[model samples]
Target: MKNRVEILAPAGSYEVFLAVMNAGADAVYLAGNMFGARAYAGNLNNEELIKAIEYCKFHNKKMYLTVNTLLKNNEINNELYDYLLPLYNSGLDGVIVQDYGVMKFIHESFPDMEIHASTQMTITDSGYADFLRKYNVTRIVPARELGLEEIRDIHDRTGMEIECFVHGALCYCYSGLCLMSSFIGGRSGNRGRCAQTCRLDFNYNGRESKILSLKDLCTLDILPEIIEAGVFSLKIEGRMKSAEYAAGVTSIYRKYVDMYLNKGKETYKVDKKDRNRLLMLFDRGGQTDGYYMRHNGREMIADNTKISKDLGEKKQYEEYIHRTFVEANPKIKINGIVTIKKNNPVTMSLSFGNIAITIDGPTCETALNRAVSREDVDKQLRKMGQTMFELDTLDIRMEDNIFIPLKSLNELRRTAVDRLTDAYLEASKRNNSHRFLPCAAHKESRNKGISVHVLTYEQADEAVKHNIQRMVIDTEVMSGDEISRCVELCRKNNVKSYIGLPRVDRGTYNVKSNSDGYMIRNMSQKTKCDKEVIADYCIYAFNNYAVSALEDYGITGITYPLELNEKELSEMDIDNGELVVYGRIPLMITANCIDKTSGNCHKGSTLFSMLRDRKNALLPVLTCCKFCYNIIYNSVPVYLFDKLDRIRIQPEYYGIIFTTENATEVADVFKCFNNRTKPEDNTFTRGHFTRGVE
Candidate 1:
């Protein structure tokens, strides 16, 4: 038989784990008490996780641990090994990783454990998938923006396993690249403490709407197509969701996956009853098919889902819980033998999975009353209730007239079961003992030149004319002949050019292979171009290990993560690293367009508006309507011109990003950066360069 696709579910707690497994998930992803992207979830502890693993193993399912949060240098150095060691030994099937440092450490130390690239990595294409293959990443969870064709192409070209999100809540910003919550409220999403700022209401052009909220994804009708595209795993995203939601979603997906597997493509059909149950379970706005079909369309927006918000739906969820979690769990049957003798010890031996445990109870005495009947012995032995095991068979070779206390039998059974449980846990154990090897340091940077990032050809022309010498053009803004002209203008002015890829490119990539190089804003870009790649900060080379790991992929240069402060930067080699010294840093690169929600769609024109938050700060919303994405920029651009003195180490270049700025503003910003001075007006922030993220 052909291998069936995996239906992966999320588990926030042990109860949810059981619900998911019983609902028919082939594998479940969960986080321990720490180091998971869903930090708010009621995650598992070490002991509970171990038990969860063993339970899955016993039930013929798999459990993948989520270590998919970015770690600080201190956390990696102090807490990584201790937190993961026991779980690794307890036979964790796989680990979903977001941090490159975490990936390298785990892969080198364990070597055999499977590493899955988490969606937080924002992987979008085959090249990015291939880049991770050397690090022993067995699977890639591509950014949700990728279409079916893109997913199939990634799998076919890379020959690596592809996993996609088929259903559940969708993030407004592309995963791994969001920093809005951190910038606004000092809670970092990359560190797993997202405040979900996207779900809140914002005023845009006098319209109050949840501008950043996207409808939950539902792909029930397209399961066969997704499977046909060679997606090995279909994942549901809800680690922070409730157990009822877990059971309901898992049960529906499981039923369909089995139906497809058993009935084949010709007979595969999406049942209407299953669809209605899913709709009743939960939805945001309504449901969108997501970016799987086309690039940017209004259909994907989840502006209003008030129907699912009704409290009456709570009863539906409870019914699902009752039907799934309230059902009886499967039991393990063991053939037990009990022996009783006169004036000697009575021993009971139990066997299970290559391990056997024998318990000796109080010695039997000569019968003072009627001899213990067979029915009495059977009834006592069959009380293996509420445990994983049941009394499938019980053999009694009792000494004639030997009397045994009823309490002793109960004690013998309980002891044997407890010992068997431990034996089973040991049988599923794995071992990891290797230590991490550190990378050698590089020389410090000697030069710090200025590079301008422009969003349009006009800006690119002006940038090169001003002898900026280096220009990064946003590809979403420049396309076809305009893109070619930007490159031509840069080359004519003896200015090196780099194509700034969209942070979330899901459609067919139209990158020119002839550019000098590609500024890789996301991992999925490398598969689009074979050019020598420059790593953008969104790729997150946060630690020395992450830098060394990416360097192995032949990446030419790196941009240190913007989250790091001066003290943290001083400790690492910044020779090849570039710093963003000036820019209205993009707070959000999101799919749910604030423009669409601001009722700007009826205008049928592009929108450039401001989202005024509760603080009364107006953040610029840059809409790439064609691409179906919106970038909400910080009200205060990140300007560290004066803070340059605090930076103990230097990088090859300092980058200034221009999103909404005109030619005059761009020139003024560059001049201030060049002179090592602040903007004339006090309209900028020293973002995370002096104070790092939490």
Candidate 2:
């Protein structure tokens, strides 16, 4: 049989785990008390973990543990390794991870353990997913930013086992690459303990918050398409949820997948009753299909409710009680009466076995019998003090008579509390690691690297002064005086600037020129040609004409607009120059800003996002805190620091830019870049546009 869409469910508690398993989940993912991203859930402890594992195994179900948090340098040392050793030994199927350091550590130290790349890694394309193959990752959870075609393409091209989130909350930023949550709060998403401050009702500039709250992703109708795409797993997001929710959602998805596979596409309809049942269970901001279909943002729905808030109140009560009694235990029979003697007047006879324990008033106390344990017996008698009393064992107690107070028993309650506290504390200790590894720095830039679309003269001067080897001038930004000043600056500072010369108007560079005498005769097609030619022209303009344009303007090295692979540059004539290394990859080109995409800006409609994955995360759009545009498919910012040698496609200008709300980190980037020498080019100079003595 073909690989069916495997239904993956989340289990935050032992009961939820059982519910999902019984509801027919193919596999269930859960987190322990600590190092789990959801800090607010009734997570399992180590003992419970063992039980969960054994139960799943006994039932022929698979259980995946979540280690999907970003780690700091100190967090990855002997302590973490020690904790992980047992988990690895416990026959865990795989671990979901995001950070490269974590990936490298797992790859080298525990090659036997299966590593599934977390969606936080933001793997958007097949190329990116292919990059993880070297690490022998068993599967990849692609970024949610990808469209259906993109997902299918990545699945087909890489042939790696792919998992996608079919339901649950959607993040505003790309998974794994987000830093908003970490930036705003000390709790790191990568460490599996995220303080979802994102969901708060934060207001900015008197408007509703836009950083943490986001619509949930729901893809009930697209099961067949997802199955057709050959994704290995369909994951549901809700580690912290009720058993009812787990059963309802899991059963619904399970029923639908079976229907589609058995009877073919369009053979089944999701029962309306099941849909309503799901709605009553839990939902945040309603639901959305997200970016699977198109780039539009309005597809998300919002149906905010008090379900989570109500459930939270219940959780607090559970924590204090230490035990959840679904129903009162109807065992352990005892009936007794006590007599109280005092100087004043108090005597009482009580029979707890048959009474509800309430009396109209306190009367003279009588005892059922002389207490075997006097201290325990007196404790009950003291309340009825100061009068004569008679005592008896019971009014009519039989040997097998059953008795239990509707009220709680102190001895039983105390025992349960101690048990719970022990469990919670031990689990806490097992997961807590106070430190992380020392922060590692990225590789050094060869020369000052490339700058593009600079908005000011100071930006130009800084690039030139720093040896920013190449600069790219957007066609609209290029001016005669500006170009002249830039050319002069490059000469003085030993830098190079590439100006965007309009290809349509320029001779051989512009594809649209019909004039044979003009340089356009050498071009393959006009400006409005096919996309392949457009791409080709963009590449060629950066590699050839842009360089000449810079040289003509008294500059030497020019930069390019498009990020290119070595193969693309090799096909075209290009000189050595730096390309954008570390930073967010710009995805969609837009004429308007994202403010217009803000939906329902009323008091209750503000949206925020969190790096819902296990890592540095933030709501990207409204907050712009750690927003990455290319998150539609999970992927990280471009990291070309690894391959500085083969980069060539220089446009009229080129530069490397690092943007962060934190200034110290930004400054640190320049310092770190200056310290390391490139393996490809030892002769390269730092902070320089071009290598030379002015």
Candidate 3:
């Protein structure tokens, strides 16, 4: 029979791992004690992780480890190899990875291990998926913002396995692209320490609400459609939740999946009780269908006023789950045979599925006291206590009046079971002897001058008046004609002109431009333009390995990561890097439009709005209708005029980005950086230049 869609579940602890597996999860994705996106989850240690791997292999299920966070240079270089070596040797099924550097290291050191691209990689297009193909990325968990049609297109085009979240809490900002938590409180989502800043209340046009909070996603009703869209694995998202929640949710989804596979979609239907049970487990007010059916909508936001399940119902459900899946430990069934003769040594054989093993014991003597009966041999062999295996059938073959000590029979049974277990574990073990080499340091080069990224023509005109190296015109904000005029203006002033691509490309934006190069945010945008591509900070060249990886793609220059402090940056080789010295850092690039959610969407028009935090700080929100996304900028722009003296490593280019600033403001900020003077106002932030993320 053909295989059904795999049901993937999350397990924060070893107990939860067993619960989900027993509840019918085909595979479980979990984290070790380090480098996981859910840093606060009760992650397993190295020893427990090895045991989890063995359990999965014995049960014929799969296990995937979550190495799905950006790794710092020291962590990836010094610590990662020793951290992953044991699990890799013990036959870890796969690794869900975010960092390009980590993927490269794992692929080289453990060549047989499969790599699943984490959703934190922000993969949205097939072009990017195709790019990762060379790195041995066998599967991709695309950004949750992608629609079903978009998902199908990716699967059909690249033929890469697609894993998607069918049920979970949703993030307002796209995964891997969020800096709100990091910028706000130094708890970076990229580093697996998100503080859930989006769930906080923000005032939008005098209305105080959790505007950025998204409802939990529950796609039980649309399972058939998702499977038909070529999703190879259906993932449930709640590693931070309880074991009961993991098992309960897995059981329900497993029921429906089996229903759909056994009896066609015509008979696949979720009962009301099961849906209510999911809600009783946990929810953010209520749930939404997510971006599967439609893009973004106001309905997708959590309604905090909605009624929640009572304590009694929740307690009852948890009890049921514990009794059903947690307490009940599923055991492997094996057939056994015991042979006892007068002169020959006593022997026992055990068989499970395709594997069979036999053990030899002490010789059987003549009748001394009482002859060993078939019942005696069967009783001793059936005593498989505390072992994973349970005897389904036991056959006793012996000569009449054969005397065998019960102690010898017990030893024979124990030996047979031990050999079977060793065989099972040995089958899963791998022999990867490859060694990892350190990434080579980049050669030092001369520093390039200042470059400006402008979102408006007024800022562009003001930027060209100064002595700058290059100018990047954002195509999402400026028209083709306006961009062309700006390019010509830059050329006339002896400045190289580059076109800035949209943050999220749905394959609608035109890439045709007569310019020096393209400044791309994602990997998919790299293939769209043939010009000298300079990667934006969103591409995340955090470490030397990542820098080397991006450079191997023929990228000309890379932007320094905004989350890193100056000390961290000093450790990295920044010869071909650009440091953003001035600008409002983009906290979030989201698919949900702030304007449309507020009942005022100007079709294909650029608009500005303010999101007032509880402290009365106004964060600038840029609604780019043309690209159909919103960019939430930090309240204060980063001014490093005085701090420039503290930076030890000088990058190739000093970048100045203009987002909400007008021509006059842009000129003032530019003058401060150029003249090496501090701004009079105290509204500027030093950003992550001082305190780096944990």
Candidate 4:
């Protein structure tokens, strides 16, 4: 028989874990107390996670832990091993990971543990999936924005197990590429402390609305298509939700998946009541089919109006779900035979599936008052209350006059159940002797130079006139001929020109070969391009191990992550790193176009849009028509020219990114940085240089 696809549910707590498993989830993914994406969720502790592992082993299900957040240098060095060692020994089935440093650490420390690439890795293509094979990543959760064809192509090329999100909330920006929360409030989404800024209201082109909130994904109608697209696991996205939501959603999906497997797609159908139950469980505006069919459209966005659920309907559904799945305690069935005879030790043999155990009790006594009957012994042994096991069948063989004490029978039953549980736990234990090898130390560099990244030729022209050593031209906005012109301009000024690839590579633009190096943002570009490569900050080199991992792929230059404070940066050995001293940091790289959603799309023309928050701050939105993606810039640039003395790490280059600046503004920034003087205006933010993400 062919292996069926897995229904992967989310469990924020132990109760939710049991509820989803009872609701028919093949596997459940959850997080421990740290390094999880949902920091606000009531996560399990180490002991509880071990108990979960044992429970999964007993039930023949699977559990994957979520270590899917980026780790800092100190966290990786001090806390990572201690945090995972217990889970590793308890036979954790797998781990969903986002950071390269965490991947490397788990691979080395827990060799037997399976590593799954999280959606935060933003793996949109097969090349990146193939690149991760070196770290022994057995499965990958691809970016949710990929279409069915793209998902199938990735599976066809890499042959790795693909996990896709079938239902739940969706992020407006590409996962792991969002820095809005971190830049705005110092709550870094990359660190699992997202402020949900996307769900808030914003004004687009003078029309005040929730422009960034996307409708939740619901793909029940296309379940067969998703399975046929080569997905091995269907993932549901809710760890912060209640147990009722977990059980309700998981049970419905389980019902449909089984129906499709048993009765083919032609006979498969969804009941209207089931659909309504899902919405009533937790409604976020309406639901869309997600990016499976179309690239993106206005229909995919939620309406501007608020959606209020009926309190009566919600309460009724919650009670039904709680009683049906949560309060209901499922037990393991056990068949047993009790042997009782006169003047012989009483014993009971219990069998649970293939596992069996026998327990001995006190010696049987002669019948002084009344002999113990089969019915009496059966009644006493059947009291398997508050235990994971249920007595399904029982046989008793008693002598003509045998009297067994009630206390002895109770002890025997308890011992048999305890032994069975112990046997399962012992069977689930794993041993690993692999030692962790730390990355080699990097030499500190004292050389300080300036590099400027430009979006337009005028910015590049003005940038090269200064003492800048390098210029990075964004290929998403500039045409091939325009890039060549910028390269020629840089060449004339004796500046090294580099091509900056798009933040999201949808296989549209080709790598320009005439540049000094390529500035890559994603792993697919990092693996496909054959040139001097500089890893962008979006690649997330938060620790030395991540930097070493990038270097292992032959990447020499990497940009410093913007979320790290100055003290954190100073602690790292940033010899080959480039620190962005000045720039309007791109807060979000979204697949949904702001112009198209607002009914003002300029077709294939690039235009600048504005998004005003409630605080009346205007965020620049760049619509890149070539790649069909949007780049949302911060309200103000990150200026650190005055704080250069406070930054102790002397990276190879001090980089500046010019996004919405004109020719004169670009020249003024370059001159101020060169003179080591602060800008005249106080509008610029210091970014995370003072207070880093928690």
lDDT of 1 by residue, 1-694 (tens): 3468999999999888888887888999999988998888999989999888888777778889998988777677778878888778888889999999899988888776799999898876676766787787889888887788888987898888888999999887888888899888778999889998878887777767676777889999889889999999999989998888888898889888888888877887888877667777776768878888876566666657355554566686667576757463867888788887889887888887677888888888999988776677777877898887887778887878877878777887888888777877787787745767666788575777767788877677667756575778776665657878888888888877888877777635677746689898776676677687887788888877788777887778788788887888776654677788888888888766665555466333444678988678899877776566778889888888877776676887778787787888767776776677877788788888778877
Model 2 worst lDDT run, 10 consecutive residues? 513-522
List ranges where model 3 is wrong by over 4 Å. 1-3, 370-372, 400-407
Task: Give the poorly placed runs of model 2, Cα more than 4 Å off.
Answer: 197-212, 301-458, 461-492, 495-593, 599-694
- Whole-model lDDT per candidate: 0.80, 0.48, 0.89, 0.88
> What's the TM-score of every candidate structure?
0.89, 0.53, 0.97, 0.97
Deviation in Å, model 4, residue 237 alpha carbon: 1.2
How many steric overlaps are in each model, in order?
Answer: 3, 91, 0, 0
Question: Where is the poorest 10-residue window by lDDT in model 4?
Answer: 426-435
Clashes counted in candidate 4 amount to 0
Which candidate tops lDDT?
A: 3
> Against the true structure, what is every candidate's RMSD?
3.4, 18.5, 1.6, 1.7
Higher-ranked by lDDT: 1 or 4: 4
| Residue 447, candidate 3: C-alpha displacement in angstroms | 2.6
